[model samples]
Target: MLYNAVSTLGLSKRLQTANTELQLERLRNNDEIASGKHFDVAKALGARTGQAIALRNLYDETDQTLKSTALLQGRLGTMDSALTNILSAGQDVLAAASVGLGQPSPTGSSLQVRARAMLEQVVGMLNASSGNGYLFGGVEVKTAPMRAVQGDESGLPSPIQIVQDAIAAATGGTSSPQTPAETAAAVAALDDLFATPSASPLGFEGGFYQGAPSTAPRLSARLDRTTEIPYGIQGNDPAMRDLLQGLYMLASVDTSQLPLDAYKPYMEAAVAKVSGGIEGVRDATAQLGIHRAQLDDIAAMNTTQLRILNDQLDAMESVDPAEASLRMNQLEVQIEATAAATARIARMSLTNYL
Candidate 1:
């Protein structure tokens, strides 16, 4: 078959262009070695590198979150243990008080002293600091949750008096110690205490102390953080209130004057209430442990997921040096041969034979 020379030349030129493009594509995709001024190489590397960078960032963020959760779980666990100890101490005091009240000679005076000490220890635990700040003072990190002032021999302040005074001052009228006559009157008084705007120095109003006052003098008895959930138990809570009231009543009672029969119920009631409080604390501690365990499980799962994702990313983007080296050598030889062929082809001309 007769072939056209112009067509043949065009075909040769097209074949050369196609071969050059194929070589460039292979080099770009392989990315075995850093190539200078190759657009295809940059494009290929940019795509794969971007994916790797994104994966790495995701891994890093997951790791950080896992670490933070771990820290929170650990803190919670420590706080739980402290609460358990405080509960135990409170129980011991109540038991001692109960036994003492039953006896005629009342071996209970020593028990009272021990109970007072334990209560003080409980206070210290509630104010326990986690190095960052107090754990139990709610958001008030700098201040202790409970304090015993010297006003009375009692280690705790008169909460009822404080509330009453604050309410009276806010209302500008004395509250009836007896019944309020109507629910509306009582609600109105409460509204007055709570409705005072935050702009007023008293804070969110409601006669409630949000956090320990910064300027308020420190209490002689502070809650211990090392042995209790700092501020886990509130003074106003019924269990604590009953326990304190019982203790105060016991302290005031003249055993010589009062018959054992009259005091028996008081001792029994105090024991029951205090025991209940201890159980409450134990239950709370157990719940915290459960929460901590859940957090640990979540962290472990996240870690495992991250590891798998990292491995997948590595497989997709990472190069094997040995395989890359072999491919690179083959491409180099092919490129050299292509160059030599092109040079030889270019020198050939019809005029040389004519």
Candidate 2:
């Protein structure tokens, strides 16, 4: 009989290698079961791996956009609340003016007090902030939009002083208008200071607003792939100017100082301005509502897109839990069997057969 060499070392090394491979496969299957994704995505997807990567990137971008839209929605909601309060405050001032005209207090002192308080309240509203930034600051969100023009606490001039200056400028040193022409001129001066864009130190931009210039475009945000919306409301909005002008006019003067004829027209001018402001604010609120509705529609579309993208990613990268578990069990059995066979073969010797 021909003698054949039994290289047990070589056979044992091969069995050990096979056993290691089986153990590695078992670990991979276990990972797949736990994560519900492929252990080796590139190896599994091969040539389509680039597509998988692109899809994942797209999903992340969409998710970011949705989150941004949600944040903007929250900001819009905050703006709406501030605007609602402003409207209510304006109405309060309006009611006071209307009532005071019919039944005048001895000096219209009570109405002035009410107007001052209302002006402070409205300024507070304009200076309102969301957690992210100021609501009425336009793009200058880090700063308060309006200054406090209420008490002597602030070194800044009060609304009364501003109106007094406007009156003096218009009438050439009169404490109050003495005639209809003077009244019209005074009102016009007040409008110029409060509502017109001018270099006057008492104007809305100089005395009140400390935010982005009204000429600057309002803050805008990307709503979708192609749509951008400018939704920010500024403190220097025409509506805001009109309201502040009316409030300052009402707050600054004493009816007792004016002739009866001048007093009636002055109060009428102020009330008319307040009424215009109220209407303008309502329109602003309505415009914000429309933008909010558009955001809602965009949110819905994003949600649907997210679902579809998730499904596509799942088809490309996700593993069936049941199938992965079954494979893991098979791999476990195979690894155990390989370990046992390697152990037995490692101990093999030709002397035992002999």
Candidate 3:
């Protein structure tokens, strides 16, 4: 067991280096106070930390989406409220008109004023806008869904004019009659005029009232789809035309000549059509609400998923303090023992024996 001095020193140096390295590794792995600078365990933990950070990012994104959905839903709800108000106004007008027609000596001036007010309110509803854009404009974010025409004898707003303009524009340049025709021949001529590429190139070309094109011209609102939702009603839609014409006729009828009983049928029919329009608007509002609710549910589900993912990431990345403390203690003991052995071995010199 005789060992040369140089060989013993070399072995001692190697042992010291190995013990120091082991202690350093333990320090890195342990979640305790560090004795000196060390990074072996930290390097391994760093990889896990990176994964945790990525998971956090994902959670953030999901949370953001949830917030955005909530904001949009709120906007949609506001639009629905506006629609409800508009419907209420329309109902009021219909009720007043019906009563006016029922009066023994009908004076429809008051009813006509009320009807005008209701029409204005309907225009307001059609022009409702949200944060992202106009709600009724059907993806036309910049343009108002309904435009009002001022100072026109037609009593229609600019939005209606825009519709006519679009139709006229589409057909090169030919203006259709603004007044309703009295006789069947006149109506037939009007229909032919609408059909002959002279009045409406962009309207309905066939049916009972075929040849009359859509009043509201479809505009490109969606980039992916060419189909457009005409946001306004045309005067040609039998329901709308009849309603308007009936109102005008009522306004002109002399209370002294035509008995109120005679106009009752027209008033009733107009009321029904107005009611139908209100119902249609209500249905659309309900559909929007449902869509919003579904989005909310999806957002909630995403939030839950994000939470679970975060927990999993924490488990994968977080340190176990108890285990780290135990490893640290074990390494300390090994270092002390190695130091004692080295001191003893180094002291066993030939000079001591002599």
Candidate 4:
């Protein structure tokens, strides 16, 4: 038989290609074992490659959004907890103030001292912050929501200062008391100031909040492509305003300092105001509870979506170790056999046989 040189060379080249393919198969199997993912994504994905990639991108974006919402939820949650504590403190102040109505001890007494401490706690909570941001500062996250300093200056509209001045005028505590007409005029002035704003303290003519008088903006988070929800409140809700007014009213009116006969009307009004404040705080806290519940729901949905998306992605991208190993072994054996055939053919020369 005639030895066709061209055919022999072609056969050798084919064997070399097969050997390279075998080495690549072995490397791929090793990668699959180490990474648990397919080494040949294009081949594994086949006709659905574009669809699978799009789905993966969507999953990643949604996951990122979910993580951000979770962080927001945490901030809101911290604010909610602080508010809850303040609500309890407000209630405690009311309960203490309501004790022994006519027989109460004088200023610096147990009940009055406890009321002052509780007022301090409420102020601290209003000024509370979390994660480097003011929880109740609305869009002004970096600034504290309330000014907590005490002021006795005349005509100062700061809520605490107003409360302080009123009580001082009524009882000769810091300032001298006024006569019937003068005292009536002072009470009317306070009544006009509080009632003018009517809706919220933010609406008050003189700034009730130390921060900017801008209405607190609600914080919003996207849950999905078409769903966005607002989940934040501020220090200036009507309910919060009512609570502060109630607390400060009680704090200012030291029943012991005032003449019980003359200040009977003032003391009775303070008690009524605080009682209403307690209910207002509960209402505000309940509203926060609803927001938290919604947040929990969003978190649950996010978790479920991640689980399903990850499972789907894994099914498309993961390789089975046993199957990859068997294929690798088959290629290795074929490469060895092909190498032996090519070497044997190269050595068979016409002259050597003769």
lDDT of 4 at 51: 78
For model 4 the TM-score comes to: 0.77
Q: Candidate 3 lDDT, tens digit per residue, 1-354?
A: 995545678878987997889877665665334432223434646666677567778777776766765666566676667767765776676676666555433446566556656666655665666675665543345655444323233343333333334433333443322222212222343333334234543322221122124543532222112322223222233433333323322232232242344344434444555666556655655765665566566657867877898777556655566666777788888888888878887887778658
Best by TM-score: 2
lDDT per residue as tens, model 1, 1-354: 995455436656865885697588566636544532223433545767677667778778777766766666566666776677677777777766655656434455555456556755665566566668565555565755555311233443343343344444443554321222322342243333333243324322212333444333322211111212222433333343334333433332333333455345435544565676676667656766765566667668778977987786656555666666676677777777766766666777888558
- For model 1, the stretches where C-alpha displacement exceeds 4 angstroms are 1-54, 101-105, 148-262, 323-354
Q: Candidate 4 at 52: error in angstroms?
A: 1.4
- The clash number for model 2 is 0
Clash tally, candidates in order: 15, 0, 8, 0
Candidate 4: worst 10 consecutive residues by lDDT? Answer: 174-183
State, as a TM-score between 0 and 1, how close model 3 is to the true structure. 0.51
CA lDDT, every model vs. true structure: 0.52, 0.85, 0.51, 0.66
What are the per-residue Cα lDDT tens digits for candidate 4 across 182-273?
A: 33444444454444354434223344554434454576667777777665566665556656665665565555665544344444555566
Residue clash pairs of candidate 2: none
TM agreement with the true structure for every prediction? 0.54, 0.90, 0.51, 0.77
TM-score pick, better of 1 and 3: 1
Candidate 4: Cα lDDT at 199: 40
Clashes of 1: 15
